[model samples]
Target: MTADLTVVHARTLTLDDALPEVEAVLVGGGRVLMAGSREAVRGAAPGARVLDHRDVLLTPGLSEAHIHLVTYGFSLSQVGLHGARSVSEVQARVAHRVLNTPAGTWIRGGGFLLSELGLGEYPSAALLDEVSPHHPVMLYSRDLHMAWVNSAALRAAGVHEGTPDPEGGRVVRPLGCLLENASALVARAIPAPTEAEFLTAARAGAQDLAERGYVSAHTMAFEAPDAPRALQRLAQQGELPLRVWACLPHERLGQAQALGLARTPGGLFQWGGVKFFADGALGSRTAWLHAPGFADGSGTGIPLDPPELIREVGRAAIELGLTPVTHAIGDRANTEVLDAYDALRPQAQARGIRLRIEHAQHLRAEDVPRFRGLTASVQPIHLQADGPMIRSLMPHLESLSYAFRSLRDAGAVLAFGSDAPVAPPEYRANFAAAVTRVDDAGERLAPGEALTELDVLRAHTRGPALAAGWDDEGIIRPGARAAFTLWDRLGGNAQALVF
Candidate 1:
């Protein structure tokens, strides 16, 4: 049944420096054999089966550099609140869901930003209490850094007026919300999904990404361990469509080592990094910042992992052949992480592993250069929503915020993603956010920081490919994996084409 070759005739953008553009590509055995003019490709493989796509544009398959795959899949079935602009709207949505389901069942959903809700202050339990007094309810802010809960759920987790805040997190006053690690108090009480449920979610997530033209993703770990297990099961059954590079939470490093886990590549799924958080996120008012933080006087945000621990564990992770991927949002967090990475850089370089920083969202100009030789895994889609907040909260650092071009010019590899479940994995939004530099309010936060279309494309493709150590992907040339995204135009309607 196998053909000698599969000749794809289209406007191919190889994304290779040598063969930047071609009219046709001949693929066989899941790898590209020749890329050149139609006649040349036909000459290379005379008996090849031809797939003529004359008007379409073929480029390397897109890669989502950061996402919670299973979490996003689960979110698809939950109550959606991403565009809810007012507390009343949220109440209405929750009330509608409450009307359909039986009483007393746990209700969970998220995607509302505090700023978007037009709340002058932290929301109270009374708001949600008015809607679902009998049902336990927990909702997450847009950034997933904060949780909003009703009184019923609060009591279930044993949180009370006298509950002391956990380290690296806070219990907001009046018993309504939790920030950072504090959210885990209530979250732990929620029943875990069964293995079958996990497998279903994994399939849903991977298939969704593949349908959106993504050939691979880097699933950051913050979920139950069962999440990656589901992915592994899918890979074992040969049912996975997208290539996945998953990470383990640093707390599970011991468990990973005990299980004899190491960086094992060349499969549909692989473990490539150990994830650590240096600070919380912006929407939660918990992004650890420098002095004069939050123009509204919220004080410098909370820090999660201590720099010393990051340095020590990071060295161990690198020595184990895993990338030390740290999440650093605020300027102070970035500075501290940079300091830690500086100490571990020599060892990482010796091991041939490039350390990575997720959410390098905000930075100090001085620390910008320190990102040299590091992977800045960022979500430009956040800029569309975070623009006004960045201005209102940290005007002093406005110019340096989301400094994509600056980091790239200073030798940092820019890997773009959407941080799904926080924001939908919509590549068009990423393209618009980075290329236009315009926000929801129609204001340009940092117009000078805008990137060219090609620049953004590379970040979404080649950058992620490098991060995952997949030399054969994210390019369309001889010997490269025959996975491509056919686009109507660059950054336009697209679909995945995997040979």
Candidate 2:
């Protein structure tokens, strides 16, 4: 028998540091069988079909370590506000969507930053009402920390000036914005997408990722439960093209445990982590800081799911063999989560599970080194928008924001992603932001913290695989996943392919 397929005459970047570059690769059983000189491969598999791409550079396939997969797909069909630069721009976009949309239909969109809107002050519901009085509109900020709602939408959710802020969140005074869990009140009012809509969104999200050279993604479950289920369905039907590591929100930990869900190994998809939020995001001024917060006097940011709650639930996750993945974006938030992790470290290590912190953005100096050995599931692309905000709001900690170099130096594993839907999963953007350390305003938050292309590549590939506890997917070597990204240049345009 000729055995399987072979890809010959390609400049394969094996990513095995000791002997990194190779001339060709052979694949079988959906894994890399051999990677070396093309002539050697030809001698071994004389009759194997050849895919000649000697010019293209092949590397391990890119994996998005943190993303809301299905949600990113669904957002494509919903009202989109990603590029709105000003409040007027947001209003205009909402107005445009409302015009074409049916009456009484709910409007939803996200991916805007308060700073980008030039709002020195919190915006009121009145701003959106001007353009959309008849429609109920709710738009989430890029951070997923806050939501902006029009008056009609507020009233539809029965939120009035007297509405009390929910614990761990707030319903802002002006009746326009809802922070953290409060956003859910308004979100609940929107109609859930139908099953067909979900399938469409999943396909859209997966295709978008594939188009960007991603062979796998670790989808953080900020989306509804049905979202991950939809992904699982796709994988079961063999329709999913990318490897998926799905997570459950912490609230569902008990449910998952009851269902006897445990760490699933070896497949196109698996359940590997339980996700939690320790605080909100900086863009929405909800990231919990220590003290002396924004220079402009926005009080220490809002806290979300408490560290204690995370710790309590984290124990259960460990027993179930699921990694504890928490979103911690502020100095205080990071500090608290670290405290909890310190307490759980023993158990986590015993179970051979890794602890992951999403958006380990801002940090207290004393806590920097503590991240060693943990997975810092971060989005370098967000630094472009967050850099200016950190300078203005948390100036004291500016040197530590997105401290990629510091974290990596301290022995932390950095898994980089674009946090798509929140930002496009543009690997080029990630490469640019991580390597250049430039923000949207053209100012470098911390030039010293910038990483080189090689460093960024490791985080985008190796780091994510390590976090998912998959030693076989990120490296292009024998026994490794045959998935790969063929980049024109290390940091340039690329295509993803899986055998």
Candidate 3:
């Protein structure tokens, strides 16, 4: 007996249509050699070593379809304020971090919601200054679409009360917050990490995901150039755990084309899409909406990359055999993106490229059908917190928000992710949010949009694989990759089993 293969005996939920459930899977050479009953598997791979997990549910490995990997890794150490309920609470947390951190160092952190903090207006820089006047601070809102910088940070970035706002972004009055592109004002001032530092962060992020049962992730391109380079280094060094699908910022499309970068799929890191943002986020009240903006008098959110730009660059992306991915949160943004995609759809389909829309968070009744062939890369966990906000801010769109079932029935691929660094890569939260359709306030936001446990599992596994064109990674079958997540209970705690 060679003892070269391993037979994993578990109650398997194979997402494969032919045989949806299997009692055992024989894995070798990082692939599924055979999957069937315990008796059949042992007979096929005689004397193979057994890794028994009959008590746990074994399904295809989990994938975090959207995350800022390196940033999240770095955020592990920053001051966390994810659930602060008041301005005083936020100040206290910042003050606590200042006590331990050296003076004059940048104090960076995020995960706060204005609604949670009962904020009617953006906090003034003075509030943060009250806590850490000596150290420069830049805390992001929960959505990562806004930044709250202290006075010292404002000065460090050369942003004064008189400084004009940058194009397509806003610099709030009283000098505490920056929105959209304006974030670059202070962001450019932050020191860039060395290659070694970048590598450290990349490792931390990837390892964290693997420990939490994710075998793969799709890292969004909303990061610096050093970000992906560090990931590549990690992959080459054989230290990377999660198989990564990377994206290039649309702003760098010219540079990418110049460097001959397109859909280069190999190894652990693969570049497959060009990323764009059609609007801001719902939590930020910056979502680009149609007619009568936010019900709360927040103007029809700030539009980012224009639809014209998406159409132009999207075509070029498709021509290079890459998918064009856009983030659209509001009805108007979705409508505009859908319209732009309509023109680029035929060309994309001709090349076997699929158009993807990230955070298809909101849509009109008429716009739901328009998603028929597009990939909706959405985050279910977001629905948990954004429910109350949706009701209060965009009441008109509440029925259509986070329409998971609607999108699925319309023939759209629903890839789920946590949008980590904004929210933790918490699949349990995703399960609760998507299945219950319950928000933070305990009210059901869109109950009709809810999905079953199996549906969510498929979205987290198979949907992401299809979106990234990694055909062998998401399902559990004879030819599929040998990656599985063992859960004590479905949608509960789990661990990855990878050959």
lDDT of each: 0.92, 0.88, 0.93
Q: Which lDDT tens digits does candidate 1 get at residues 1-499?
A: 3366799999988889998999999999889988999998888778879999998989999999999999998888888999999999999999999998788888999999999999768999989999999889999998889999999999899999999999989999988999999999999988889999999999999999999999999999999999999999999999999999999999998877888888888988999999999999999999999998889999899999999989988887887789999999999999999999999999989988889999999888899989999999999999988999999999988998889999999999899998889999999999998999999999997888999999988999999988877889888888988889999999999899997
Candidate 2 regions with alpha-carbon error over 4 angstroms? none
Candidate with better lDDT, 1 vs 3: 3
List the candidate 1 regions with Cα displacement exceeding 4 Å: 1-4
Worst 10 residues of 1 by lDDT: 1-10
Per-model TM-score versus the true fold: 0.99, 0.98, 0.99
Ranked by lDDT, the better of candidates 1 and 2 is 1
Query: What digit string (tens of lDDT, one per residue) describes model 3 on residues 274-300?
Result: 999999998778899999889988799
Sequence-dependent TM-score of model 3 = 0.99
After TM-score superposition, what is the CA distance of residue 96 in candidate 2 from its true location, in Å?
1.4
Question: Best lDDT goes to which candidate?
Answer: 3
| Better candidate by TM-score, 1 or 2 | 1
Q: What is the lDDT of candidate 3?
A: 0.93
